[model samples]
Target: MQTDNSYANTFATDSDAELVLPSHPAQAREPQWLAFNAELAGQLGIPESLHTTAAGLGLYSGTELPDWIQPVALGYAGHQFANFVPRLGDGRALLLTEIIAPDGERFDLQLKGSGTTPFSRGGDGKAPLGPVMREFLVSEAMHALGVPTTRALAAVVTGDWVQRDEAQPGAIITRVAKSHLRIGTAQFVAHKITQGADESLRQAFADYVIARHYPLSKDRKHPYRALLRQIIDQQAHTVALWMSLGFVHGVMNTDNMTLSGETIDYGPCAFMENYDPNAVFSAIDRAGRYAYQNQPGIALWNLARLAEAWLPLLAKSGESQQQLIEAATELVHEFPIRYEAYYDQKMAFKLGLNSVTAETQALTRDWLSLLQDHALDYTQSFRQLADTLETNVEHFEKMQSWAAWQQRWHKLLTLQGDSDAVVSARMRQHNPAVIPRNHWVEAAIKQTVASGDLTIFNELTQVLRTPYDVVPLELSRYAEPAAPEKRVTRTFCGT
Candidate 1:
């Protein structure tokens, strides 16, 4: 990672105009990307500088790309969301390698839009610039806001065009993450139980996750059970964090779910504006299956498939897999309680409440009810909670529930012995004043394509980088949704 000043200096493109990608033939002139990954023999910490040398480009300036990418397309099976889809794997993506950081922790460098694979499923395996930048910006934003996510290492505009809806140029994003694999990968092997390689595959998958993520994940022979429990807890919080932030992950398929529990796929995803739990933004998500409120359920449903994959390992001699199934069932069933508790804690922090309890759930519900009535901006209300000193509710037209919630909030702070300053500080930490609102992003995208002027895009990126901070007045270009004339109801998946 480079210093902020240095990164800013490098981000400037006018002086180094030719150094950056320009408006040209995207399809023919695009660079053919090469993978830098871990080798099959478990060679680790391949310095990134080697990749720059191989690519023969200065896109990284003096920085380097990792060496020895043991690139492999992992095999997996998933339930799409809830309904079982028998076969699903790395259709078009590839997990390049695991980078062992200076601290000895590993993160995956997976390439999206690189090229097609055996699992192409009759679709072109390429990415456009818009979605590439979207993943980079939003993933980094999530990281800054204390959410675990795959970091975008770099975005390269492949000067090639990929035809989906329109003929658009292709690009590749080097996404660094805790891991590229999912429980679905494990399920892919487990579901083929009759193949006799089932047990071998399950053991290998468990070992891989433990070795890469939780070195201590397997202290005992049956640590798979423990590892499974740990993943359940992490995924619970991850989804709740997404919900708290008003994020709608257009596609929450099994293979898209990461084993390390970070928010992974960004295709066709959008941030909500007027906060509807049922809001569907993905052009492909005609049904509200993977909606905002539906995220947690979908997460658990995906986890269930993973659990089923682990059933063979859980089943012992002649007693049958149901014993293992019962144990797995218990773990999956715990998702709601974990989610609700985590959600309440997150919601409490958003509202500046320190001493939250079952009683406070009423106040929280009432606040959301008011939010729905007023169609308030979800991000704004929590961000403004601390700033507003009025005892009565006058921010919006409605006042009854707001007034009551405010009173309860004030009372809770007093009971918890916390000052207004402390509560405000806490609220600011949890509540982001701004997100990559759909309308603003769409406008920025249109502006870039229509005029090739990246001023609005760059400005929004700046605001998004510090999502928790208040946006400046000059940056108000990103503050609101597009009016009736500019609204984009559907977001496209840059396939």
Candidate 2:
């Protein structure tokens, strides 16, 4: 694969700005390789000539670059929870270079947990083994579930320990993304505008985003407005997919929201077992701001920040500033409608209906109500719907309400004009049989972090790859919900 440095070479600052500075890892150790996603590497047309042993993965973790590569730490600002922070950037990460595949697709090859940068902000620039493994597992699982997300290219243990709560093994994950442009990146640009930066800078960044992710927008009558609409649409569909699979992104900060709409940060994310709309797993979310049910709203909030940043570009064609804000605000308001539409369509498929309507919506809502009221496992409930159709038995025999719901669902399926075979096939296609269940993820993390044994980690990662397929009985344990005591009530950011 070829490489590009457009972002570092064009947009990034060379000065020692508040959010941008040059730094390197305090220590780069031999990689105790845990995993490398060869499937993704193959798709990117990564040359086999560049392949290295597990221990050699550490070569990518340091400041020293291959002759063809140039590395830069990025700068941005984000709303931590709901409060806007003026500056936050690549505190412990670096954008090594943008790799161009044989197909001409560009992907940002970045190092997470590589080391300290100017944005480290007095904190250690490192990641523990647990979060590295968690990101690797869930990001790949999201891909298998057909969600667009940043893919994990490689994960290597740093063979060093970092103090977090207590001492834990340090590791680095090579994260691959279409681009690292976040809403917060735009926010940072807007901050610059507030400090008397020229409109030319804002337009340059907008042009860069259009070229990288939304090429069609460059030809539009008002490209900045077009870019905002495209981003809003992508984010709407992305959050809807997350909701369909019972995934909760514990932190929905602006910095964590990607312009490409791929789920970026996997820091405190989790998949729900029980179907509570208010489910929150991130320990730092004291007020449930980023709860499962609130994702759609928070996503819209983040997009509004992106819109604010692009106002200058939007107003360049002689439109009044107020008129531009009104137009962009109106577009942001449409996010909820778009998100709900996607959610309805996804839920309809999961309920074996080809189209959504008032009746189908009620059917879906009632089913979710049953799951919530009875505290039923989220993924299993939908997966079991197929089993119920086949055996004519209620999977949850104790929930009499489910039997009644099933009768209504069967009638709706008939009204929808699909045969049992067609509907069953559709439901199976959308409802995954496996997710990275919290308890199972915690178990795997324990094995690797506490004992340095990868047996459980390897097995779980392999099983999650075919999330929608029927698995061998030997791997059936992964399909089961955690016992009451085994549930992981909360997860951390692993900062």
Candidate 3:
């Protein structure tokens, strides 16, 4: 019985994935050489503590893949999608150690796309280089966008390859998150209920979550229920954050949904270019189950699955269970109002209004409608509106209703004592100067991978990092809408 580095540390070993790498040493250096992954600024300062192992760098860095960093099989079950799966651990992942930062915040270092585990389900447990790079690029972009999300620490193209879609080489990506516990993990143990054992599991799960993410709520009597509410709030804000920025988490499975409320499982995710609202990119989502518009609903549905797992903790007459169901359902019910309020509030702020009022609601809709009607780019439209409102009268006049909107906006400014500079400055912060536009991402991907060019990727990343900054040189190129012919309708999952 070999205990891994994780077990040796304060953390317990839970799951393991196979060690796989890309076939070409030169190919693996795809990112740093071309895109140049900025060495990942360590805002958390947590990873520095880990006894660094050989997670080979571009092509292959001297980092020896540590021998004792054994794979740990994690235990958990969940309702995958809608089906009740009794067992589903890390099918292709292993828990690396938990690093406690100087600030006392603990973060998990997991090796995904590493190798197969007991749960690989006869599929190749290895990940291709493309997905690894994609996740790395997108996750960093998400972090910069100010969304609560799991971050990618580093990507290594192991000097190994595994056959998948024409024998592509394998790669390893290091994913860091605040916590690895998901709704599925709670359900896995709860499903093992022998009589009143379910209640015991919920109690344990609640204690675990409260201790980690919501420590302040641990002593409460119904701590589990409270944890659910906290998760609900975070998830509501998270999904709103996604929508406001046109992000689409193509797969929102219960197992993929993290209790920490940070977005995870970027298996099939993309951002909308044309704002279909119901746009989906995952190849598997034929029924549009996880569309952009449906994220909040699917989120509530996932929460229901979690509530069902905790039902055993309720009571004998099933009366306690019913109350628990109501509690969970009420939170789910709160999703729409909460989501709408957030979206409207954000949209209001973007439109330079203090809050969502009847006047502002109409103004906001008119703006979106104008963009949609002209097939104007979603991000650019909002961002440019702020700049145009401030400087260019001709550009503002061409947008038909802007003059009237400006007048009404002025009236509302009276509500805030309307100082032009103050209002312009506030709106600029609300509207980002740049976003990971689909076309821009695709172009960068092509330049870096196809043409072996680093300029586009470097420029995009530089501009993306300071989304709110208005650097004239970077802003014009970064903020411009994609050419009509270049607009990408659908993005593919980088499997």
lDDT of each residue in 294-385, candidate 2, tens digit only? 99999988888888888767665668878888988998998998999999999999988999899888988999998888888999989887
For each candidate, what TM-score against the reference? 0.85, 0.96, 0.83
TM-score winner among the candidates? Answer: 2
Cα RMSD of predicted structure 2:
1.8
**In model 3, where do residues sit more than 4 Å from their true spots?**
1-41, 44-70, 73-81, 194-199, 314-321, 393-406, 451-454, 471-478
From the highest TM-score down, the ranking of the candidates is 2, 1, 3
| lDDT score at residue 10, model 1, on the 0-100 scale | 28
The window of 10 residues in a row where model 2 has the poorest summed lDDT is 14-23
lDDT (tens digit, per residue) of candidate 3 on 246-356: 888887878888889888877677777665666887777888988888988888888777767665543235366567677667756776777778878887878777778
Predicted structure 2: lDDT: 0.85
lDDT comparison, 1 vs 3, better candidate: 1
**What C-alpha lDDT do the candidate models reach, one value each?**
0.67, 0.85, 0.65
Model 1 lDDT tens row, 35-62 = 2222211333434553545442223211
